[model samples]
Target chain A: MKNFVWLLAVSVSLSGCQHPSLAYITNQGDSTVSVIDAAQQTVTHTITVGKAPVGVAVSKELQRIYISNVEGQSISVIDSQTLAVTETLSIQGSPVGVALSPNSQTLYVADWYSDRILAIDTSNTKIQREVIVDKAPAGLVVSPDNKTLYVAARDSNQIVAIDTQSLTIQKRIDVGVHPFGVSLSADGKHLYSVNVYDNSISMIDLKDVEAKTHSIKVGEHPYCAMPNSDNTKLYVSNTQDDTVSVIDLNTRKLISTIKVGMTPEGLDYDARNHQVLVANWGTNDVSVIDARTDKVISTIKTGNQSRAFGQFVMQ
Target chain B: MKKLLTIIALAALSFNAAAHGPSPQKVEKTIVIKAAPAKVWAVVKDFGNMHAWHPAIASTKLEKKGDETFRTLTLKDGGTIYEKLRTADDADMKLRYEIVDGVAPVADYNAFMQVTAGPGAGESTVTWVGRFYRTYKLNPPIPAGQDDETAVKFVTGVYDSGLANMKKVIENSK
Candidate 1:
């Protein structure tokens, strides 16, 4: 019995080593996705997709990575382990932002030009339903409980929440102008929207709907945001300013601002590696920020025009 | 809100509509000028007097509204370009600007000019960088004058001529 327990522990750690964290950086200019292994700090594969790949949704359980090709009007599904494009789903409109449900059964795609949200069945690759929301639907995030999917309506200046099960609009929460990137806390207790034009972040309380939403001022022309695992802080990438604003969530104050590459766009928190991977659109590089120190430790050059819009890290 | 709708509708229907592109473009050009860092920066920092150095500009008009400063440049090619001054840091010898609206075949154009000490004595390197998107953003069959190549070529030409003339003007002076 004692030997069996020791063997089980060894096997568990072996599985963990086999599956290192990976970051999928969608390069829009080159129309390819750079799959980087976090442990090695290098790209393992460069999978070519359709034209203008902008968004990424990684599913660890399903072992798949879905990439939205805005100009190609399709989604390229890549096998996470094999690093190969297995299938391509033809979308009707231009797909920009993409998200996966907690259960990984439904993939939500925000069509930027069509102003609609598409719920594609994961197992079959068929779009189960689509609903027209506003002028432009850009960012999307599903709740931890898999009950709600929030989308940022860019031109309408609102965050629209839709019921995942019923596939219906629940609430149109007004946010700052040009809210382009939307994210939810790990615990699903708060929602943050990055207003590109307003240069601010809106934090909405999910536990208490009656609570007043708080708006935190950030740098110029903020693009995307990501929250730490503990929900104690938030990081926003300021595109125009070429910096990242670190916000202390408890006090709702700016903690620090770190300068990065020009036109930093997509950002994702790597919990396993305790790092933040930022895609620099202008410099075509990935700036890796150490979450503990809030400093850029290294920068890995990627394809031309890297904009990993959605959650790209798979732990 | 209604005005925003009107703007969108007009942009969609206009023949040479200025829509956004899927991929962003960048152009960075550098020239080693035989001058001090501060001296070269003085020419770049004089945002209102670009026509003095750049041959493509016929004249420049500077206006200030509240805390914001704007400049209108009348091109020698019989066109005009409006731009806003973002920042001018004397310490770093860097100036940042953005195009408000112009005949340039680009949208959301943001640029910066920086002067740094060069590899040789009594010399400074000037770097001009521009980031923007093509005016026509839709998928295929882009307009002749609004595609990515056209936009990049136009901006490249502008930078080449302006930098060459600025070099000649600065080097020949004194």
Candidate 2:
């Protein structure tokens, strides 16, 4: 009877530790990452990272998180299980944006100052190669097929697609002025670039590369974009306006603008809860919006200068 | 040869210093007026009549479009500024707006004005705050008028003068 009671107590404790999902937010000012449990809507751990961590990417299959520290000029790798920084890979130039391959075996770091992209082997965390591209690469996205990589070259005002195998530039499509964030539809048929200076989004049809791009006007100083699971809607964070502009993919027009916290920069779509998580830089909090209603449901406080640029939610 | 080398070194250092990217900045100013909080709120919340209280604003024109209110302010120097009213809450005595287009040497400008009861009876405190980035968004060698310092100075001057004049107008009236 005593053994059975101890066993039951252990099982109950272990079950409580299991979290359905986690959202990792990079706090630029504090140089730390706040890990929030989606189920509980609370920050479970705050892991110390390098200086000015702005970009974040997670590999659910591998259970690892990659953070780009722009000022520190390095990438801090965290094991999702341990919720700790396992290693830091130093790269020259200012590393601002990051993405991982579909297989979670390779990592891509965009160096804004160096004007190039560095590919690292994820297993060993070693610099595999570097591909030189346009000026000031700020955002990155991998194709669903995992064959191409799209980069938002801010200064050059273009999106450059690279062949992953060859690690060479495949296509250069002209976009709006100072495009900073890039995203793709769930089917990978359309590509979107958030243009900061023009306060617009450039929608590129991937099926026909030469097709004229459609520019949709959004709020001021838009930083990043995230598409829904079904590609029916797109959400963008306008930093200066402090609002999220909802775009209907069918009409390709602005449907609504939801007010958020100050300096909303990075955003991601959570498939499980069907919510959008936005990192507010000035307010030091995360605003969770209900995708169905397009309204802010809750605001969870994080560290200072939160900018979780890339895909931060662990599926 | 030595003089030429010194000039080259100085130019390189300045260029390097100017190449840093623009960072967001804030400017805030507060004034204590003898008027009551309700009186101060009335003047501040009138989004269309900024020229009446602000010394620098020469004229103001208000327009409404698609459920949004916009105001155009002509400054004393003949420069004009276009702003959109984001929110106005009477209960909180707070008004928020953003610059749509302007000649203020700043980009992505958002401002807030609030009026509250002061330490003394019948006295009110008014505060004006603005957050903005430099007009030049791209990586610098920023131009003379579009640098971070220029943006900060322009916003500071606007807030300082506007609040000072607002206090004078509110206190002197009635």
Q: Cα lDDT of all candidates, in order?
A: 0.87, 0.85
Q: TM-score, chain A, per candidate?
A: 0.95, 0.94
Say which docking band candidate 1 falls in. acceptable
Candidate 2, superposed: residue stretches over 4 Å from native: A1-18, B1-174
For the record, the alpha-carbon RMSD of candidate 2 to the native fold, in angstroms, is: 7.9
Interface DockQ of each model = 0.28, 0.11
**Tens digit of per-residue lDDT, candidate 2, span A133-157:** 9988889999988999999998889
Q: In candidate 1, list every pair of residues with a backbone clash.
A: none
Q: What does candidate 1's lDDT look like per residue over B87-119, in tens digits?
A: 999998999999887666778788999999986
Model 1 reproduced share of reference interface contacts: 0.18
Best by lDDT: 1
User: In model 1, where do residues sit more than 4 Å from their true spots?
Assistant: A1-18, A208-210, B1-19, B137-141
lDDT at position B91, candidate 2: 95
In model 2, residue pairs whose N, Cα or C atoms come closer than 3 Å (at least 3 residues apart or on different chains), thus clashing, are none
